[model samples]
Each structure stands twice: as structure tokens, then as C-alpha cells.
Target: MTERFYDQLSKDFEEMVSWRRYLHQNPELSFQESNTAKFIADKLRSFGINVKEQVGGNGVIGVIEGNHPGKTIAFRADFDALPIHDEKNVKYKSSVDGVMHACGHDGHTSALLAVAKVLNNHRNQLKGKVVLLFQHAEEKPPGGAKFMIEEGALDGVDFIFGGHLATDLPVGKIATRPGPVMASVDAFKITLQGIGGHGARPHQTIDTVAIGSRLVTHLQEIVSRRVDPVEPAVVTVGSFHAGNAFNIIADSAILEGTVRAMNSNVRQQIESEIRAILDGMKVADRIEYSLEYIHGYPVLVNHKEEALLIEKLVKETISLDAFVEKDIVLGAEDFAYYLEERPGAYFHVGAHNEQAETQFPHHHPRFDFDEKALLQLSRIFLQLANHYLVTD
Candidate 1:
């Protein structure tokens, strides 16, 4: 069954490419993928699969029930693009201005769509059912996954799986690791209030610029000095705003940044440290301030058994050399929300092709990956589906 599915996927490779390129050219932003959702639903319906639309804000769900009874397996793919201008000169470059599928969500969608076609074609031979989650708003926080789950996308799901196209890894290879594969994403904003005055009369004003500068420095120290060296963490001050004029002292200053940690304890510790630093600044600098810390996605922890299953399937289905045990990344994935609810694992399919100018990292304007990675992704999802629906 797996061999037949692989052969069918190989034959449908061009069709998959067409789907991917079409989506890449007409990319849509997170939470606003109405037309993309329609396109996906229409394709699934054409394949004779049961389709559900407008799920959790533009998410699409397709289900295929088998002739025999067995475990229900779920697969997920995000379809949201980023807010970046297309810079690549390819013929299929994004047609939308100031918005592009810079993160390979287009590839993700096309891969899963191809898999659904193959699975739906062979639905009678399978056991139990297969659920395809075409998710939205993965690039933005409070992602569509959360809402989709609340709407029962995984209501009957026994095990779930997801994959990403990784430029960091070479093509024909895939990678995964059990436990905390990605960090928790959180952000913060600090506003400092002080008295505005003439630059020459420095003593008359609290000088928020000076205080905010010191605040940035102290914030950096949280990861370096406060958090344990063995524990991986990051604190980045991405934006800072102050006075417009160089000669005048600004009455207020605003600083915005992000924080990442591998574990909940470390995550909490960082927030506490930030608050403590703010308190110290208020007492020492005699300035009023506000700290707004926004929590995004949680750390992505792959289930040990499920992750091992992916590694094994990659080695057996693809070449043994195609399987790579990767290290934990600081990047965050909203897929973490699914794994938290159901037993599952998320892995990366290598899409990097140095000879094709496709080595740019994700979320970059020029970012792209070898389209051949789509076949690799579909192969894995098909193998996973067969493992649970047939072999088990």
C-alpha cells in the first residue's frame, strides 16, 4: 500500500508543483486567507473528499474514512504567508504586493493537498480515517490552530503529525528530535514616562532616553547573567523609539522586544527577571514605566515515541541517510499547540538547494526552497498514515 501511494505521488509530482506555484504566486496573509481556503476546499471536493470550510477562521478540514476500523490519524499544514515583499525573480514570484509566502506555507499546503488526493483515491483500502488540517495564521500569534482545536478539528484524532520545509537542512533529508524541539515565543513592550525639558537643563527632566537605554542593557543581561548557561534562551530588543529632535530631551521612551526559552520554568524566570529589572529602574531612576508582556506560542515538544516513529519511517521509506536527528531550535511553532493536546510529533523536510539559489532562510524576502521537497514531505505523511491505518 505504501509503495503504491509513493508511486502515485511520484506520478502526481508535476500536479503538486502546479498547486505549489499557484499558491506561491497568489499568497495571502495570516488570518485573511479567504480565497486560499476556497481554493483548497475546491480541490479537496474535486478529489471526492469530505470538506469543511470556514473552520477556526479560514482553516479547512478534509476527512477520509476507511472501509475498515482502526485508529484515526490527523495531519496539519499551515497556509498563511508573511508580510514581506517578494524579491525573487522567478516566473512564479508572488503576484501580491507587500505579501508573500516567504515561510514556505505554500509548499506545506501543496504537499498536504497532494497527499490528500492520494489518500482519498485509496480510501477503501485504508483502516479508520485520515483528517487533513489546513490551518491558518501560523505566522501570527494566537494562531488558527488554537481556534481550530476549540472547534474540534482533533475531536476524534488518536495521533497527529506535521512537517516543515527547512532551508537549514539539505534536500532529500528530514529531521526531528523528541522533547522541546522549539522555544516558547513571547514578546514585551516597555514605556518610560518622564519630564521633558531643554537639553541644556538636564537636571530638570528625568531623561527617559537615558533610562530606556539602560533598560535595554539590563534586559540583555537576563539571558546572559540571570538564566543558566546550560539552558538556551534569547532576549532581543527589536525596536526602540524616543525623541524626534536630537537637542531636546524626550519625555517618554518606548522599547519593544521578544523573548524565547526552551522550558516553562525558564520562560517564567525570564519574565520575572524583566519585571524585577523594571522595578529597579523605577526606584533608581525615579521614572514611571509600563511593561506589557504578550505571550505567544509555547515551546514545541515532540512526543518521544511519535518522534522516534517519524525517524524510523524516514529511514525505512526514504534512504537511511535521509534521516537526521536535529538539535533544538530557538524558533517557535504554533504546531506546538496540537502536540500539547494530542500525542504527535513535528519534523522538518530539507528544502535547501545550494545550486538553485534556494538557500535563503525562512521569512526572508528572497526565501525559497527546492520544490522537490514537496514529494519528500508527501512521502513521509503517506508512510505515517499507512503505519497507523494499516500496519498497526
Candidate 2:
């Protein structure tokens, strides 16, 4: 029965490609995925799956119940695009300006939709229920996963799984780890208030630009000096704004950056070090500063058993060499919220292809992945479903 589903999915691969390309051309950003959500709900309904709309903001859920009783499983795919213009020269390039499916969310959606179609068709021959989570706002913090979970996306789910198309890895390969697969993301903005004066005078002005520069340098030390050497952490200052003119010593300057860590202790330590450094600078320079630290997604730790199951299934369903034990990524994912609530694993399907010019990193304006990855992702999800649910 599972083999029959795989054959059906292979036959419907073109439909999946059409869905992905259509989404890529008409991309929407983050929480503003109204049309995208509608498209997803419409597709799921067309597959004969029961659709639920407006779930936790723009999230969409589809449920497919089987004939026999068994363990229920949930699968997730994010449907949000990034705030980047489509720079690809392809015909399917984004029609929306300054917004594109730069992170392969379009591909994720299309793949899962294809899986939903096949599974729904074989529902009579299967056991247990399948929940499809068409999540929104994955690129934005306070993500759609949290909201969808709050609204009971995984109420009776026994296990959940999600995957991303990795343009960095070669096509047809898959990778995952047991725990700490992705980092926790936190952002900070430091505003320095000082007296403005001419640039020529050294003593008259408080020199906020100088202070901000010092802060940027000091923040890097938090990861290198304060955090334990064995622990993985990062503190990056992405922005610094001081003055418009070169001849003026700016009265105020702002420093903005992000912090990434694998665990809570290291995350807290980085925040503490940042505050301590700022407090010291304040006392010595007589400068008043305000720091705003915002916590984003938590670290994505894959469940040990679930992750190993994926590794085993990848080898059995695809090939022995298809599974890769990938190193932990510092990138943050909102799917971490789902794993926190349910036993699950988030893995990556390689989409990079040399001849297809699809090796660009995610979130880049020219970012794209080999569409073949859509079928690969669908195959993995089907195998996972078939493994847990009884098939005729």
C-alpha cells in the first residue's frame, strides 16, 4: 500500500512543481500570507482532506482520518516568504516586489501538499489520522508554530516531523541529528545617549559613536571570553548607526545585533555579559544607555528516537548513502516550538544542483533549490507515515 502511494506521488510530481512555482511567483511575506494560506487550504480540500482555516493567525490545518485505529502523526511545512526581491532570471521568479520565497517555504508547502494528496487517496487502506500543519510566519519571531500549537494543532498527535530543503547540500541527500540541531535566536539593540559636539573637540563631546564602536567590539568578547569554550554561541553586531555627517560628534548612536546559542545557560550568560559590559562603560564614561534584548525562537532539539527513525528510514526508503549526520546549525527555526511540545525531528533535504544554478544560500535574493527536492521531501514524509500507521 505504501509503494502504491509512492507511485501515485511520483505521478503527481508535476502538480507539486506547478504549486511550488505558482507560490514562488506570487510570494507573500511573513504574517501577511492571506492568499498563500487560502491556496493551501484550497489544495488540501481538493485532496479530500478536512481543512481548517485561520488557525493561529494565517495557519492552515488539514486532517485525514484512516479506516483503522492507530497512532496519529503530524507533519509541518512553513508557507512564509522573506522580505527580499526575487533576483533570479527564471520565468517563475516572484511577481511580488521586495518579497520572495527565498527560504524554500514554497517548496516545503508544495511537497507536503503532494504528500497530503497521496495519503488522503490511500486513507481507506491506512490506519490512524494524519495532521497537516501549513504554518505561517516562520521567518518572523513570535512565529506561527507557537500560535498554531496554542490553537491545538498537535492536540492528539503521537509524533510530528518537518524538513527543509537545503540548497547548500547536494541534491537527493538528507541530514539530521538527535539533539540541538539548531540554535536559539535572540536580538539586542543598544542605544547610547551622549552630548553632541564638534568632531574636532575631544573633551567637549561625550562621543556616542566611539562608545557604540566600543560596545560592538566588547559584545564579540561575550562569546569568545565569557561563554565556555566547549559551548557553541555567537554574538554578531549587524548594524551600527551614529551620525549623518562626518564633522559632528553624534549625540546618540544605536548598535543592533543578534545572539545565537545552543542552550539556555549559554544564552543567559551572553545576555548577562552584554549588560555587565554596558554597565561598566556607563560608570566610566558617564553615559546613559538603554538595552533592548528580544528573545526569538528557542533551540531546535530533535528527539533522540524520532531523529534516529528518520536516519533509518532515509537509508531504507532512499539509499544507504543518502543519510548524512549533519553538524548542528546556528540558524534558528520556529519548528523548535513544535518539537518542544511533541516528540519529533526536523531534518533537511538537499536541493543543491550544480547544473541548475541552485546553490545559492537561503534568504538570498537569488536563492532557489532544485525542484527535485520536493519529491525527495515527500518521499521521506510518506515513509515516516507508513512506518507508524498500518497499511493495507
Candidate 3:
């Protein structure tokens, strides 16, 4: 029976990695996860499973009905943590100073609470419903999966599953790819304005730090000479201010960053070439510009028949060389708003372990992983909810 439910999830996989390192030593941020959503709705109501609690704010949902009457799957996990600061001294570190699950999301919420205790102990050999969701503010900024899909959490979800914890993939390995895989975070801010002077009077004014350093090299030539170099854009300016008295010559000069893309017509032609390079910067002849663009999360595209049914249910429940495919990440995911409202697939679980820990990389303030990949993500979410309730 699925190898006795993966041998009782490998005997409680060390109490699910000590409840994912005590939720990575108590981290919480983004919509401030009320005690990580009451410790994941009291472990999904102690696996009797059917808890719901604060739909959008703290976000937790756990259902699990089955006993014939097929299809309705979902298994998300993201409790949110990361204002990053626990420099990993590990013994369940981070007693909250600057919050830090550093993004294994405490091993993806203890691997969906060990797949909600093996789908509530095989809910009578399963045939239908399974929803677990538990998301909170996935690293902030209009996310928590768009407020749990505006408080419905995919109303009657058909198929959905998620996983991510890869210090660049390695510990037993698992990745998937089918379409855009991940990218499409947009954010911009530019100020510019000019009319300050006296830095030794370079012709008396208009400088805005040389028009924000020539608009950050003209916004890195809009992803190198205007997008399409096989379409995979990025235009990071990561922040720039103006002058604050080095003899003064400032009058405003902001310019923030981020702009990644993996199609969406190269993310709308890099936001229309960053508004025509700040409306063609005209410093000396009356400078004045302002521009702001915010659009986060929208690329994680995976659905090619749910990535070939999660690669044949991860090669029949684990290790067909750990089902590899991956590579298409500019990195941005709100789970791309649940694959823009259903038709899911977002995989990758490999919490790298280069000779027993020292991998750190997701939002790093010393990230950590290898909690034995949470018993292979709770046996691939109980074999994708019993293979989509017996083949959809």
C-alpha cells in the first residue's frame, strides 16, 4: 500500500525534521503568520483533517474527504518567513530576530504536514477530495497567492500541487519543467527631476546625478539591446539614489529595480522599454520624469498536462533518477497566482546536501535544508493524492 505509506513516512522522518526545525526556530513575517497559522491549524486538527481558519489573513485550509466520488486535489504549502536574519548556528536557530525561515518555508510547512498525515491515514483508500493549502504571505508583496485566490483558495480545486526547496537542486533531486517554469516579476520606480546646483557650478543646475547615471546605463540597454536574445530578460538596477552633498548637485534621482521575464511578449516589451527610457531623458533642456511600474508574479507556467502528470507521478512514486527537467528561472512565484487560476504544476524538491549541510541559497541569511527532503515531500503528497483520485 504505497510501501506502507512510505514506511510510515520513514518513521515520522525524525518527527518531520523536528517539525521542520521548530518552524525554523520560530520565524514569521508577511501578513505576520499568527504563530505560523496556529502551528498549521494545530497540525491540521491533529490530522483528523478538516480545519479552515482565517482564510486570507493567516491562511490555512486542510480538508481531506474520500471514500469514493473522485477528483479534487490541491496541496500547496508556503507559510511565509524572511526578513532574513538567523545566520544558521542551527540547533533550531532563529528565535525570531529579523525573522527567518529563509525560505525552505520551514521545509514547505513540514512537507504539507507530512501530507496531512498520509491523507488522514489513507482516508478509506481514497477516491476524492484533498485540499491543503496553508499559504501565508509568500515573501510578501501582494502574494499569499493573491490572498488565497481572494479568499476562496481555488474554490473547488481540481488539480494542484507545489514544491520548492532547492539550494540549486541536489539532495535526492526532483525538478520539473514544461513551460515558462518561473519568471515575471516586474517593479520599477524612477524619479529624476532636476534643478539643484553648486557642485562647483557645472553650468549652474540640472544634473540629477547626471540623470540618474544615465538612467542606469539606459536600463541596461533594456535587457541588452532590447529584449529578445532568445527571450529571457532581466533589467536589475536594484536601487540608486541621488546626491546628498558631495558639494551638492542633486534635485531628485531615484530609480529602483527588478524586471524579469520569460515571455508575455517579453513582459510587454520590458514594460514598453521602461516607458521609452524615462521619456528620453532630456536633462539640460528641462528635466522632469517620474515613472513607477509594479507587477509581480506571473510566469511559473508549468501545465503540459500538468507536466505529464507530474512526470508519471514522479516516475511512479520517486526516483526515476529523481525526475529531472528544470531550468528556466529568473525566479518569481506567487505560484504565478496558482498557475493563473488552475492547471497546475510547480515542482522542485532537492534541498541540497553537499556532504551533510552547508548549502544556503533561498533568500539567504544562511539558508538551510536537507531535512531529508521531508520524506520525499511526504511521499509526493501521498502520490499526488492517490494519483488524482484514481486518474481524475
Candidate 4:
């Protein structure tokens, strides 16, 4: 049965590419996926799946039931594109200005659509039901996953599954592990206010740029010297803005960055250390400073049992050799929100093909993936839904 399904998926692979390319050409930003949502909803409806739109802000849900009653499982795909301009000169490059599907959300969305089409064709042979979640705003904070959960996307779900397209991994491969697949994602901002004066003066000005530069280095020490050596943590200041004139000592400097930690304890410690650093700066420099730390997403821990189930499915679909055990990544995902409520595991599906030059990192304007990877994900979704829902 699986073999036949794979063959059928192969037959429809080009159509799936067309769907993905259309989405890529018309990418939408986070929380603004109105057209993207409509496209997905329309596709699911055409497949005869019961469609539910406006799920947690532009999220779309497709419910397909088997001939008989059984358990219910879900598969999620985030459809929001990043705020990057399309850099690729391909035939289907993004038409939207300053927005493109650089993170393979297009692939994920299309693959889920393909899964819906294939499963709907085999609905009579299915044992239970599958819920398809087309999520929005994955690239932004307060992710669509939380909104979907709030709107009851997991109300009666038994087992849920999700996966990402990894351009670093070669096509025909998948990676998963049992615990701590991704780190906790957080954001922090430190605004340093000081006295402004002539840059030429030695002691008349506070020199906020100097203070901010020192602060950036001091911030990293928390991750390196304070956090556990064995634990994975990152504190990076990706943005810094200070003054209008190079000759004037800027009175205010703003530092914004992200924090990644492997666990809650590590995350807490980093936060505490950062506050301590901010306090020290306030006292020593005698400057007014404020800290805004927002916790974004939790560590993505894969339930051991669910991880094992995914491993089994991967081994069955491809070979054991294609099922690689990957190390924990510092990258965080909002899918952690869904796992908090139900048993689920997120896997990395390889989409890189060196021969085809689909090897750029995600969020890069030049980012793309081998379309065949979409079919692989579709098969995984189809198999997982059947096995998870069908009772013995």
C-alpha cells in the first residue's frame, strides 16, 4: 500500500511543484497571510476536505475522516514568509516586494496540500481522521502555533507531527532525535541612556557607543563564562544604533538581539545574568538603562515515544541509512507550543541537492530546496496519520 501511494505521489509531483511555485511567487508576511490562507483553504476544499478558516488569525484547518471511527492525528505547516526580498532570478521568483518564502514554508505548505489530496483519494481505506493545520506567522513572535492552539487546533488531537525542510541536509535524508531538538528562543533589548557632549572631550561625554560596545562583549561573557559549559546557549546582538553625528557622543544607544538556550534552567540563568549586567552598567556608568526581555518560544523537546515513532516511519519509507540522528540545534521553533499540549515530534527533512544548487541556508533571499523533498514529506505525513489514527 505504501509503495503504491509513493508511486501515485510521484505522478503528482509536478503539480505539487506548481502549487509551491505559485505560493513562492506571491509570498506574504507574518500575520498577513490572507491570500496565502485563501489559496490553501481553496486547495483543501477542492480535495473535499472539511475546511475551517480563520483559525487563530489566518490559519486554515482541513479535517478528513476515514470510513470508520478511530483516533485523530494532526500535521502542521507554517505558511508565513520572511521579510526578505526575493534574490533568486528563477522563473517563479517572489512577486511581493520585500517578502519571499525564503524558509521553505512554501514547500511545507505545498507538501501538506499534496498529502491532503493523496489521502482524500484513499479515504475509504483510511482508518481514522487527519487534521491539516495551515499555520501563519511562524517567522514572527507570538507565533501562529500558539494562536492555533488557543483556537483549539489540538482540542481532540491524539498524536501530532510536523517537519522542516533543511537545505543543509542532502535530498533523500531525514534527521531526528529524542530530546531537545531545538533551543528556547527569546529576545532582549537594552537601551542605554547617557550624557551627550563633544566626542573630542575626554570626560565631558558619557560616550554611549563605547558603553554599548563594551556591553555587547560583556553580554557574551554570560553565555560563555557563566552558563554551563556543557549547555548550549547563545547571546548575540544583531542590531546596535547610537548617534546621528560621529563627532557627537550619542546620549542614547539601543541594543537588540536574540537569546537561545537548550533548556529552561539555562534560559533562566542567562536572563538573570543579563539583568545583573544591566544593573552593573546602571550603577557603574551612572547611566539610565532599561531592559526588555521577552520569552518567545520554549525548548522543542520531542516526546521520546513520538520520536521513536518518527524514526520507525523514516526507516520504513527510506532506509535506515537515510535516517540520521542529528545533534541538538540552537534554532528554536514555535512548534514547541503544540508539543506542550500533545505528543508530537518535529523532524528535519532534507531538501538540499548539490547538483541543483538548492543549498542556501533558510531566510536567505536565495534560499530554495529540491522539490522532490516535498513528496517525501507528503509520504511521511500520510503514513504518520494512518499509523497514528488506525487502531489495531
For model 4, how does the per-residue alpha-carbon lDDT over 1-392 read when each residue is reduced to its tens digit?
66656777889899999999999999999999999999999999998899999999999999989887887889999999998998897999999899999999999999999988888887887777889999999989889999999999998899888989999899988888998899999999889999999878949878789899999999989978999899999999999999998688899999999999988999999999999988998889887898999999999999999898888988976788889897899998999999888988999999998655598898898998898899878888877876765444
How are the candidates ranked when ordered by TM-score, highest leading? 1, 2, 4, 3
TM match of model 1 to true structure: 0.98
Give the Cα-based TM-score of candidate 4 against the true structure. Answer: 0.96
Please, what are the lDDT tens digits per residue for candidate 2 over residues 60-160?
99999999999999999999999899899999999998999999999999999999999998888778999999999999998999999999999999999
After superposition, which runs of candidate 2 have C-alpha atoms over 4 Å from their true positions?
none
Q: What is the lDDT of residue 276 in candidate 1?
A: 91
Tens digits of per-residue lDDT, candidate 3, 270-325, equal 88888876776663446888788898887878888887787788877665888889
Q: What lDDT score is found at residue 99 in candidate 2?
A: 90
In lDDT terms, how accurate is model 4?
0.89
Error of 2 at 209 (Å): 1.4
Q: TM-score of each candidate?
A: 0.98, 0.98, 0.39, 0.96
User: Least lDDT summed over 10 consecutive residues: which range in candidate 3?
Assistant: 277-286
Summed over model 3, clashes come to 0
Question: Lowest lDDT 10-mer window, candidate 1?
Answer: 383-392
In the predicted model 1, the residue pairs found to clash are: none
How many residue pairs clash in each candidate at the backbone level? Answer: 0, 0, 0, 0
Q: Of the candidates numbered 1 and 2, which has the greater lDDT value?
A: 1
Flag clash pairs in model 2. Answer: none
Candidate 1 whole-model C-alpha lDDT, 0 to 1: 0.94
